[model samples]
Target: VTLSDLDPPNAYRISGEGSGGVAGYAKGGALVRLESESADVTVLHYDVDAQIGGKLAQLGARLINSTATKLAGEFFKSFADVVSAKAEAS
Candidate 1:
């Protein structure tokens, strides 16, 4: 996942790619708007979902929540690093 062009005091865009191993691969993007603020800021969210395969291929009904959480955390850090580097360059 990645966030870029963080035009501060307003909004940002997040773009990402995901692969579900033998299942499928997906990529998504969304824009986040800062709708409210105080000492802390609140964001309005948006998301997109897309896949590379048919629905019938999903057979199991298992939830790997921990794995998902870990991966998401890693992705968030990576995204932060990428955006930080870009900001530094500018």
Candidate 2:
């Protein structure tokens, strides 16, 4: 069986299920979070816990910011600033 659905921000959740006779039925999903802004990007992931082999089917998500690349420009920097201010006050 196959299922598909649309989420917010143009994200898509695609899922499927299949049986391997002796092995049993397997189910999984792929999700893509598309950015709304022109500078944003689309993030892709596979839902694992919803599968038989939970860990193996899992997809990891990460947010990174470098001199050349950043998913949220200045977002991390602003967050750090807030933390630093709080720490200084403490």
Candidate 3:
């Protein structure tokens, strides 16, 4: 994995590649940007690209996609909760 093209307090890009037994091999990258909507609101935008190969790709792409989507949703929800808590504490 690699983290680069950082724009402090605003954006960044991440990329990685790996291989496993059941999961096979995969490579992907994401560009994440933060945009200020208001004094107290910031919106995050992300673009991701991934390629799956070998057994995993041949097995079930739908299942893999849905799981990834679910995980991303959960991650953002948790992130929002933490951010809100910190703002309230401040």
How would the candidate models be sorted by TM-score, starting from the highest? 3, 1, 2
lDDT of 3: 0.81
Model 3, range 1-90, lDDT digits (tens) per residue?
Answer: 798999989999978888987779877777888999999999887776677888989997667766765666677679889998999999
Cα lDDT for residue 42, candidate 2: 32
Over 1-90, each residue of candidate 2 has an lDDT whose tens digit, in order, gives 354576765666656666656544455454545453444323333332234433322332111112212423354357557766886787
What C-alpha lDDT does candidate 2 achieve relative to the native structure? 0.45
Best by TM-score: 3
lDDT of 1 by residue, 1-90 (tens): 798869786778877776777676555555655666454434343433333433313542222333444555576568667866886787
After superposition on all CA atoms, what RMSD does each candidate show versus the true structure?
A: 7.0, 14.4, 2.0
Say which candidate scores most in lDDT: 3
Q: Model 1, 58: alpha-carbon shift in Å?
A: 8.4
Top-down lDDT ranking: 3, 1, 2
Question: Which regions in candidate 3 have their CA more than 4 angstroms from the true location?
Answer: 21-23
